[model samples]
Target: MAGESTGKKKKTGMKSFIGGTILTDERISRQFPFVVMLAMFGLALIMNRNWSEKTIRQIGDMQKELEALRSEHATISARLMDASRPSEVAKKVNEAGIGLKEPVKPPRKLVVEDN
Candidate 1:
């Protein structure tokens, strides 16, 4: 009788263990979709933050490039203006080995009498 009672207790213990695990599994399965939705929402938030940061960084780089380009344009425009001056043009022409020289005498107007 004692041996039979021990066997019955062992079976009851195994049945309780299995029953507890099954209940736990059912609860977990019921909540699985909620967990997945929360995880996806968190991932979306992280991606949005990263995308905004990257876009802001790109905008900053473009602004810096624009300022640099503007500065270069101003410098080139000034140089061009200086080079277009009459004195500067004469100096450049002389450096090119041209034979042109400033005239010393005033120009005289020629009048043709119509016949």
Candidate 2:
């Protein structure tokens, strides 16, 4: 009998806790949809902020990449300009002990082929 009374008391206590915390009152309980809707809107705003932050960081990284590419392009262009100069080419050729003599060529006849 004592155990039965204790069990009943425990069940009553559990019911009261649920009824007070979740159900609270008739008015609030009936407005459950409004609370849930507001929560969804809050989450949407947080998700939008996170997405925008990531997008902004990506754009910044892309800008840095573009700058790096431009710098590399400029460096390569400068090197090409330097290498294409006749004076530079002649200097390198002379340093490698190149002679400016013309080579003799032998004449040959071309034969036409039918495909």
Candidate 3:
């Protein structure tokens, strides 16, 4: 009777191979593939979020650069407009001692006859 009981115990001790452990359960091994897949999906989502944030930050930096360039252009354009006025040009020309004078008399055009 003891021999029969020992034989039954030995038969029960023969555990089936469960991956990554010495357990006899087949359920965890069957679900391992799905668990790894879910973890990979979660990692991909995190990476995508990080990449999008980086892109958004780059766009913001470019927008700031564009605004600075526009301000510089406006400043240069205003300076050019002020310098191009006739009064400003006359003053600068006189300051430079160029001796330029404004015309005072209305000139007549000569009439030529064509035969």
C-alpha root-mean-square deviation, each candidate = 10.5, 11.0, 7.7
Candidate 2 achieves a global lDDT of: 0.81
How accurate locally, in lDDT, is each candidate?
A: 0.83, 0.81, 0.81
Question: Rank by TM-score, descending?
Answer: 1, 3, 2
Which stretches of candidate 2 lie above 4 Å from their native place? Answer: 1-24, 98-115
Q: In every candidate, how many clashes are there?
A: 0, 0, 0
Q: How well does each candidate superpose onto the true structure, as a TM-score?
A: 0.63, 0.62, 0.63
Off by over 4 Å in 3: 1-25, 105-115
Using lDDT as the yardstick, the better of models 1 and 3 is 1
- CA lDDT, candidate 2, residue 33: 97
Clash count, predicted structure 2: 0
What would the per-residue lDDT of candidate 1 be over residues 1-115, giving only the tens digit for each residue? 5546453323335675668754355556698889999999999999999999999999999999999999999999999999999899989889998989756798999999999
TM-score, cand. 2 vs. native: 0.62
**For residues 1-115, could you state the per-residue lDDT of candidate 3 as single tens digits?**
5546443332223343323343344655677789899999999999999999999999999999999999999999999999999899999999999898866887889999999
